[model samples]
Target: MTNHYYRDFLIRNWQERDRIPAAEVIRSVLSEYGLGWEPNGADKDVLQVEEYYLATGGEFWVIEYQNQLVGTGAYYPIKRSEKAVEIRKMYLLSSVRGFGLGKYLLQQLEAAIASRGFLSIWIETASVLAEAVKLYESNGYMPATGVETTRCDRVYVKSLMTNFY
Candidate 1:
């Protein structure tokens, strides 16, 4: 899950010990966007990245900058006939906002999915997450036709067939 380093940043696969710190990174970023963190909610998946992401024929990645877990991103398998994955938990601390790390993470995630032979990627995001929406759109994620409720109001999709991983 490594990408050419972003400054001193290194991307690595999510490990069991990263659970708490990774959740902190995610929660921190969400908080900046005025999003509330409710542990009792469905976001409990953030606390169990292994079971919901890694163990589900998918993967989660953490980016370390200066030995600190500053960013987190993950893609997990979903019930789609075309070998699809959902990009989830993509967030970064405000300190790393303009360093091109988000783009790198998106690139790496798509490569990881394509490496595993997945055909497409799907993502859901709230309308309030303008930066995230821009990142997704710039990374080739277009509007998805599916109807999704219960969480995000915007859904996006991108096909990862160019390099075939």
Candidate 2:
């Protein structure tokens, strides 16, 4: 809704009830791709907010510009893996797609995750999200074999270290 020239959007932490709007954007976008994300089911984390994202040594950021939420990105350490973090819930409004906000959010999230001492950032995206796959590929993410999840098919990993394998 915010259509102003306010330079770069600001990334803010997801506060209480903040997930409502974020979920709206996410569900709307996912529905466009014929995907389903149920809040009380598969995406219960969005409902719990702090308990799932913040309390766990991870972060969720909402991109706001001129007081309107436009995008979101989140990360948390992979289960049972101390050296890796999983990138999650990246979505941007259709009106703001070509503005490089997705790339910006990825770069920023990578930096933040690395700074948290994570050696790698992991991502799982659907085969349908070509632009997202391209963004991750261009950002130095390598296709990786990992735990199979029903949420997505393509898996990518970004190493925060040069030779930490």
Candidate 3:
């Protein structure tokens, strides 16, 4: 239950009421990119944020622009390595794109991860998500393999041990 303000947007922890709207925002963004929304599959976590994220020692956030939910992002620990986390569900509506909020959200996520003593961060995204790829690369995430999600084709990893935070 934390709140972060950036310009006109408010980034805060996910709540029960945000489930539907946040799912809609994510589904809509995936649709805009011609990708399918896998509710029972890859995206089941969106329906059970508490169980998948909050309860599992991870964090989920919803982005509000003018009091409207416009984006979502989350991360949870994974068994891939020691003290590692995978960034998930980072989608922003087109209306909110190009405003650097995505980058800001990413920085916030990274700072939180680093502060929590996480040593590694991983991300998976599709190649069609060109903007996402550019953002990750620009933020020091090097290309990697072994993507675990069906919707993603590209993988990136970053070590939070240095120059991170």
Number of the top lDDT candidate: 3
* Alpha-carbon lDDT of model 1: 0.82
Least accurate stretch of 10 residues (summed lDDT) in model 3? 156-165
CA RMSD per model (angstroms): 2.2, 3.9, 1.4
**What are the per-residue Cα lDDT tens digits for candidate 2 across 1-165?**
112232577777887767788888788777878888877765677677788778888888887876777777888777535588888889887767888889878877877887778888888898887889999999898998874557688988877887446
TM-score of decoy 1: 0.89
Residue 107 lDDT in candidate 3: 97
Go through the candidates in order and give the clash count of each.
0, 0, 0
User: Each prediction's TM-score against the native?
Assistant: 0.89, 0.88, 0.96
> What would the per-residue lDDT of candidate 1 be over residues 1-165, giving only the tens digit for each residue?
655577788888888889899889977877887877756664788887767886788788888888899988888888754788988888889898888888888888887888888988999888788988999888788897664534578989888775544
- Whole-model Cα lDDT per candidate? 0.82, 0.78, 0.93
Model 3 Cα RMSD, Å?
A: 1.4
Q: What is the model-wide C-alpha lDDT for candidate 3? A: 0.93
Residue pairs clashing, model 2: none
- Quote the lDDT for 116 in model 1: 87
**Best-performing candidate as measured by TM-score:** 3
